[model samples]
Target: MQPIPAKLAALAQQENLHFLLAVESGSRAWGFASPDSDYDVRALYIRPSAHYLAIDEGKDTFEFIEDEWFDVGAWDIRKALRLLRKSNAVLLEWLRSPVVYAADSAFVRDLNTLAPQYAQAAPLLHHYRGIARNALGAMDLHGEIRLKKWFYVLRPLLAARWAVQRGGIPPMTLAELMADLPPAAVAEIRDLVALKSGQAENYRHRLSASLIALTKTLAAEVAALTAPAPPAPATAPLDALFRTTLQRVYPC
Candidate 1:
């Protein structure tokens, strides 16, 4: 681990937050980082057993930004497990991210084993649809658009399509989604990505008509599809894992 990851780990421990999983979760993880991309570190942590026994529930999330380049946030294990059972797409992506900073081996192993069992198309599709819709809605006026925003919209649109057609989470990277895109759209997007790669953040470009049309059509199609029923995950297993983790991290 580099200094950034090491510092993040130390900060978590200093707060008595035992991190079970930590990984990259944004543009960098998605394989389209620009020259000035920020580090978006997402992690899952657990408090001491005593903290869990408190009369009042405390904050379930922690956020720290040491500088413009380093932004780290985490969810407590209890909150994470609850969200996982509900097929929260963000948590699903966290588990799927390829860049791991620090992780408890057994905890990650168990989480991966449980990920597929709880995978559901409906909530995930709904989630992606919302993401795509927001990104599209936020587009700048008169064909001018942030190149990165195109990816923000396109990825979720593709993810929604993947959920509906393939019945699972989509690949985490934009390059992986190219095969399913129209030839023109893919080419345009790749060029925009290359352009963005050489530039700093806040880069914008005139939207190609073809790319705009492709995004609008895909968004419409994804929005029209019926969301499938979420899978009924077995609660006992998740419950057991939660207890086991608490015990392991705060043994007497």
Candidate 2:
């Protein structure tokens, strides 16, 4: 709905970025944005075939700012693949973001079709480890109720569950996480989400029973997240596929 998104989309098109998808992926998307949160726009696109063949080191990601409150970033197709191999959840979510500024190609459609074949277990491990490390620290050090600290902990824990349940890597969001929790844990997460959603920073959010119950459930899930991932499915020639999609999207 913001004009900023439209401007950024135009910039991406001018650079021959061939937008495949774009979406809000920051504090706003997470539902806890401050009044002036930056429009964190992300997109994927293809460059000309010549750009691919005459490769400098393939830069996987790029950023730009059309103006204040309106910045943008893009990922190259090959760069996206490299991240996909390692299970980058942010990248996966970008592929699935709810907002759409500009998307005028079949490139991501083609890539999504190939995703099932190539997405593996290695990346999910890396993704969860980083999530736990980053948020667990905040939960430990921040005041018991700091910035809805529980979401940081819960997000990664549930995502780990999702990976195990689905038998392959899938992207996660807070909205979807609640339905899958044990009743008690769900209550705890709700308390946290309610506290965080309103942008409340109570020095101490005390939900005595709920907090304890949720942490226990999360601890168990964390263990599974650290456990070895199951094997990935067979690979097809994604390079050929990428090229074919590129030719079709980025003509001549």
Best by TM-score: 1
Candidate 1: segments with Cα more than 4 A from true spot: 140-142
The global C-alpha lDDT for each of the candidates, from Candidate 1 onward, is 0.84, 0.63
Pairs with backbone N, CA or C atoms under 3 Å apart (clashes), candidate 1: none
Candidate 1 differs from the real structure by a C-alpha RMSD in angstroms, to one decimal, of 2.0
Query: Model 1 compared with the native: what TM-score?
Result: 0.92
The whole-model C-alpha lDDT of candidate 1 against the native structure comes to 0.84
lDDT of 1 at 164: 79
Model 1: per-residue lDDT, tens digit, 156-184?
Answer: 99888888788766778888867777787
Candidate 2 residue spans exceeding 4 A from truth: 31-36, 66-70, 191-195, 200-208, 224-236
Judged by whole-model lDDT over C-alpha atoms, candidate 2 comes out at 0.63
